[model samples]
Target chain A: MNFIELTDQPIDVAKVLQSVSHPDAGGEVLFLGTTRQFTAYPDSKEQDRSGDAGGQHTAFLVYEAYREMALKQMERLAEQACQNWPLKSVALVHRLGKVMPQEASVAVAVSSPHREEAFQAAKWLIDSIKADVTIWKQENSPSEDAQWVHPTNSGAAHE
Target chain B: MIQIRLFAGATQLAGQSTVELSPTDLPTNPTVGDVANCLTARYPQLQSLAAKSRWAIGSEFVELDCPVESEHSLAMIPPVSGG
Candidate 1:
């Protein structure tokens, strides 16, 4: 079984866990994505737009998606995961609109009879969603300007 | 006319979410590549994203050479940044 949702409300991790939980499955993995407080603008000019040279703090993030295509792609990924692993259930949820700092924006849960398969499936699900889903995130800085983030460059600074 | 939907950076560059192209403006039974070429011709700013973007018919991604039916919805997808 699979559960896929694109919603404007915050992701409900508990509900996702409940949905993916199966009596026969001995292991389950859950991944949650939370909004970060700081983000650097890809372009230095955007930092100038904020007028604060020292630090560029993200005020919030606005997420948008090609909803129809996103759902279809997510479903396809879930099916692919099931085919590759000994999985019993999967749940994927993503939040749209404004997401505040430290709030849950995305959640994924997968269940399998063993820990290894569950771990692998969960990792694959999140990675595939990042690479394939038709969802976009625009970082809203303190200057009240929002810049669309590119997928390739979306990583932590220290990484 | 075939409607081309733009998303993410493509939408920002095009300055509009949707652009329409009449059948007369394209090759007969235009492939996705043909439609992409027409888009770049009309909106030169989109040229940079042409190679990076993926084309989707309805909800599924399609190859550049895939034929587009008149009634199908076409979307130009830039690299995704979702979690």
Candidate 2:
């Protein structure tokens, strides 16, 4: 019953945590991804070997996605996560538009009867979001290049 | 005619996000696959990306060949990198 699509805003993580907490839920897991100053140089072996300066300091990021479909994907992802784990509640929020370093980009919090299930399901949601959803990210790096990341044969931006 | 939309990079490639094209005029109501082919034909940059991209009928991701009626709002959704 909780899903959102929006630009930057003041987040209430504590509220989300409280909402999902229940007497039967013994463990809660949270995943927070802040904007790293540098883009995680993916394992592009050839790009690394070419030595085009591996540390690409990010200037800013442009995040975009197909909102309606992304929300639907999130629903499916949550369903899959819940199926895989005995979870009581799941809360996920993601930010879009230009975000600077050290800013929060996305967060996933899961409440379950145990910690392991919460942790595993949260991880799965984030990974599936990256691999499947039609969102795109364009990173403006100090390396003097801007790159667009997307899935092969897909239309979603890497937001 | 269905209203088709593109967003972000896909929009950039297409030069616009919303396009109204006649679906009934075609041999049959076009499918998501047909929309993709038409898009690629109009924008050559889409040729490579089309293989990986997906189409959405409303809130769900539908196969490229999923039949789309005239009133459906088809969307071209590229991958996103939101945290």
Q: What TM-score against the true fold does each predicted structure earn?
A: 0.88, 0.83
**The best candidate in terms of lDDT:** 1
- Candidate number with greatest TM-score: 1
Q: Which segments of model 2 are wrong by more than 4 Å?
A: A1-7, A40-55, A142-147, A151-159
Give the DockQ (C-alpha) for candidate 1.
Answer: 0.53
> Cα RMSD (Å) per model?
4.9, 3.8
lDDT of 1 by residue, A1-159 (tens): 799999999887889999999999999999999887875455556445364455558899999899999999889989999999999999999999999999988898999999999999999899888877889888888889877776443322211
| DockQ scores for all predicted structures | 0.53, 0.53
Cα-based lDDT for every prediction: 0.85, 0.71
Report, for all candidates in order, the number of backbone clashes: 0, 37
lDDT of 2 by residue, A122-147 (tens): 89888877777656677878665766
* Candidate 1 segments whose C-alpha is farther than 4 A from its true place: A40-56, A152-159
